[model samples]
Target: MDPRQLARSSVPRSLPEARHLRQDDRFLLVTSIMPKNPAAVAHGPMLIGVTINVLLMGVIVMQAYEYFTSYKRRDDRYLKSLVVFVFCANILNTGFAVADVYLALINHFGDVQYLTVSTWLFVTDPVIVGTVACSVQMFFAWRVQVLTGRWYLGLLTASLALGQLICAMLMAWKCHQYPAWADFVKFTDLIIAWMTTTILVDVTITIILVWYLRRHKTGLEGTDQVVDRLIRLTVQTGMLTSVWALLDLVLFLTQPTDASHLIFQIPMVKMYTNSLMSSLNSRPKPKVFSEVTDNIHSIAKFVNHRTTMQDGTMQFASSLHPEAAAHLERHELGEFQKKTIEAASSGCKGDAKTGWDNAARAI
Candidate 1:
């Protein structure tokens, strides 16, 4: 210690030989400050995740580019706009998460950062990511409504999105003022409970959506082939997101605070990057004329509207296939296609080639 400096405080510096004293002033004289434990520090690289985030950012930019391309080409305006909006929100959320990690890294408190990002980032940043994430969920459901022209799934999706947003925000608020929430549990347990609930619900909801898409009417003869592909991509993206959610919850719940969070969170970020990939590939496919009416009526009659064809549109014949009976019995388009094809086959109206004769020609 400097002599003049020590004189102002009237504390003598402890030399190597005299450093054994256990007194508080003696301790202060020996070392001016005590640092947090080294065990909590984040260190070393986790290449897999960092690499993935790098790729995801690339994908987000690409999706935005694709959306613009579709509009420039005068393709389907609705799907293009949907893609742009979803991708934009994803990029914003991902940026905030990545930035939060970087801030923790540069703050020189890697240990604290490693164990408490859910608190540090979740609580402090006003939670734009949660908003975006739930919006993406609502988008998934809304697209289904667009295809079926029914509002049942859209309403359900909207409700779930709202619920998720509330829970995420509540947890963030609890962390922001831990004192206000009253330190109700051990820090580790508290965080684990929060993570478990959030991730589980997210995963379950994603699984249900994927299942719904797989069973929906989409095929060359049944539904738009293009829409089917988009549905699949959305489900796949949702499934991947669920996987990350589970992993994040488990790790944060099980691992000690001193564990290398950089090692894991980067991977968590990577897992999260799939939203960008899904968004970029989300453009609507080229339309094929094949149609099946009422994909969701089979699940449950959420809406009770009578099915009818428009006045100017051509109504087709039903098929002999077993699927035809169910299609005709339930919805107007199914009967129209079955009859349209039948007449074409029986040599009564349009040629078979233009009608059901080549149902396989669907895009």
Candidate 2:
């Protein structure tokens, strides 16, 4: 008769049939309610990267604290200022990164159109990263010159550092021009150049430092040990940044559409700052040489020398023989003095007597 009665008649009459129909409806509803966005492919990696970046920032803060507190009086003013500038830059970059993700995922939730494009905050990452990388690289370049006395090596390193910064800035501009994440592929050449220069600078610095240290190694165990430690630190810090940059490039090239590269890219800046801090903090402590100084003083009795203490500074004088002064000058002790002064200027603090002993034994 009526349409309503006819529709009711079509329903399953048995309890088992009705239960199956209910289960089918439930399955359909669940499937329809599932999110359609490719969140796992695009956003998951970003969240993970940000988390890691924050963790590393904590480490940087701790290192910065140690540097400031322990080396405040000893470190040069310019070097301390550099650390402060780098630390501030890192904080700014991290803030920009957090804002970038927050605006896209949290603030604009369910807005698929907004997530497709990056904001200005997202582009600041490259600029800030470039700044920090250039600063640290240039510092190392100066170190290279100081250690090797070759201006060309320092100039080459500085040039490469500047090149990478230029590439990074260009990449940032390109990102600003094409805000859509999909269009990042358009700047493939820029990405390649930027990462390539970064790796080149790192490798160049590492080679120069390691070569100089190895060449200057003295036969004495104490001096050679110092040189070996420097070599190891140089390799570890330099290769770490290079390998990470290479990995970021590889991931971007291989999976251009996916956001997997963000994982390495976000944390890359921290690696530079950490490496610099590690190098600055690795200098030998004065307390480590107390026993060595005692032994050295005991041996000094046999050499017929006079030591004068003035203003808390020890001065070794050849009072018994004027020829001893000429003999010391003939031994090229100036080179050793230059190195010691360089170390002190670079914020490395150590016992003066111990350094003298090491230098004398090497000679």
Candidate 3:
């Protein structure tokens, strides 16, 4: 064969073959550069949702335990009704959350669009969670007011709580109106305001409680122990909730496409309710300290004679031990009778008789 003939044949006579190879190269480049839905940041929220539901279940169990053990015995008709309302709201919240998971993942597994599309299940979440949050915060505001005898604290906290609740409701309404998960980022300002207000309210409550408890500290050893306990409890509960809210806000702002915010948002109601129940139930039971020491009588008298003043529509008490005063104001006088009894009881449990006697003498 001639050299020219070989060159001409080798030049590739088919134009379509050259175009197909070029297209294949382009396809490979695009596929390599662009992220696939499954491999990219898709499952972050789905996995978070599952974990959140598990935690929510635990919260409900704890709520039930607290209610049966303490609230049932401690609350009157009105208070018990409030407990019932909160519990019922939690049930609804959990139901809707599970439904959201089902719709977004289990029911429409392969459908990527469903994940970013807001449905009725997602729309109702803010309403349910916001209502629960508002009720709990307002309750805390009233309690803090009673504890500190400061009407302004309650008013301020309640105002923030109301603001957050309103923002949440408005956010939810926007979700319903737009009906797209992607559209939610458009209301980022409202979401930030909602989270910021809740965080402020929580931190403010913590500061007020801790400040009041510290201010009222009697130099007495037993009284100091009780005050320390109150301060620790307030800090732990208040900080945990506020920190979770902060984390949610951070994730929402940084990873708007990921539903990682749900992780912190889901169990917040449980935090509030559990904090309330713990505050109520942790007041030493009378029988638990009945045999401990004679200091109980003096503490009992102090709690019984807690200072009271009428302020507008509310009547509250003020005392060196504000926790005791809060119990008294709520008509939980039996629980109040042993406010420092646990401290006294612990003090009396020393191995040496002299230690018990010294503890008794100190009290």
Candidate 4:
């Protein structure tokens, strides 16, 4: 064999060996380090936690805007205090969420096991979210009490809210003790209790409020329309919160290891806050029904608190239904006031009192 031909053949053999050596080195490098778990990588807890934090930040902005804009509009001191508390809680939640993302993603990147370990930041979520949730529930409970005149039902709802808060706080304390996200299943009982109470309170409030509004739907077209709107609003807000809580509970119970529940958990507080703010801000304007609905002229039937008989002894009759009195008080103008305001705005030329009386008597 020629020396050059032999050398070329040797070069090919050496090339193969070199390639094998390189492949072995790469294999050693890959295997010596931990092989990444696709499941773990794909469903990174940090991914869910951080994504939720972003969403939470957006919601916090919404909450701030709502508070500032409605501050002048809301005069109820109690409600004002609750709003302040929710705003503060929302801020605290955002802070905790930021810390959660930083700890899980930035501080311990690729250390996926640490993601299963609960930290101080992770536990704080239940506390802050629970506080906001319970406060909102109680506020609606109070409304139920006022509208339905059923103190027992209101107390029941409030008590349920308190129960949920206790369970949530308990869960937080437990998380702080364990500090392991994987071990969350150990506290399944507390989770069930907390989520159950929340769902019950939401549903109870919705049912009672809706029933009361439906019952108070005075046959008059305008009043009935207002009642219908109120019913729809009640269902919408109540269902949204309750449904989220229920989903969270279901996912937590079924997939304790997976962070799937975080999807519902993250935005839960925002739902509660937005629902409360929406209801408060949407206080019906009397003009909505009185001015817009042409059938309001039928209200003349219920006008005039006083009637004169043949004997001329003055008699006062209230046309308001006891069940509807609260609803009407909130949204409807008194007969005299309605007539006077309508007359003034309409530029009707007449003695306002006389015209109101005449209209009332005609009914």
**Regions of candidate 2 where Cα sits further than 4 Å from its true position:** 1-38, 286-363
Model 1, residue 184: C-alpha shift (Å):
10
Q: What tens-digit string does per-residue lDDT give for candidate 1 at 273-333? A: 3564355445332231233323222211111122223553333322122232223222233
Candidate 2 colliding pairs, count: 0
Q: Higher-TM-score candidate among 1 and 2?
A: 2
Best by TM-score: 2
In candidate 3, which residue pairs clash?
A: none
lDDT of 4 by residue, 167-253 (tens): 989989998887766667788888898999899989999999888777655577765666677788889999999998999889887
Each model's lDDT comes to: 0.45, 0.72, 0.64, 0.65
In candidate 2, what are the lDDT values of residues 254-294, reduced to their tens digit?
A: 98767799898888899999999898777533344454444
The top-ranked prediction according to lDDT is 2
RMSD of candidate 3 to the true fold? 11.2
The best-first sequence of candidates by lDDT reads 2, 4, 3, 1
Judged by TM-score relative to the true structure, which candidate is superior, 1 or 3? 3
Model 3, residue 53: displacement in angstroms? 3.4
Which regions of candidate 1 deviate over 4 angstroms?
1-18, 21-55, 71-126, 146-150, 179-235, 256-273, 276-349, 352-363
Against the hidden true structure, what lDDT does model 3 obtain? 0.64
Worst ten in a row by lDDT for model 2: 320-329
Give candidate 3 regions above 4 Å deviation: 1-43, 289-295, 298-363
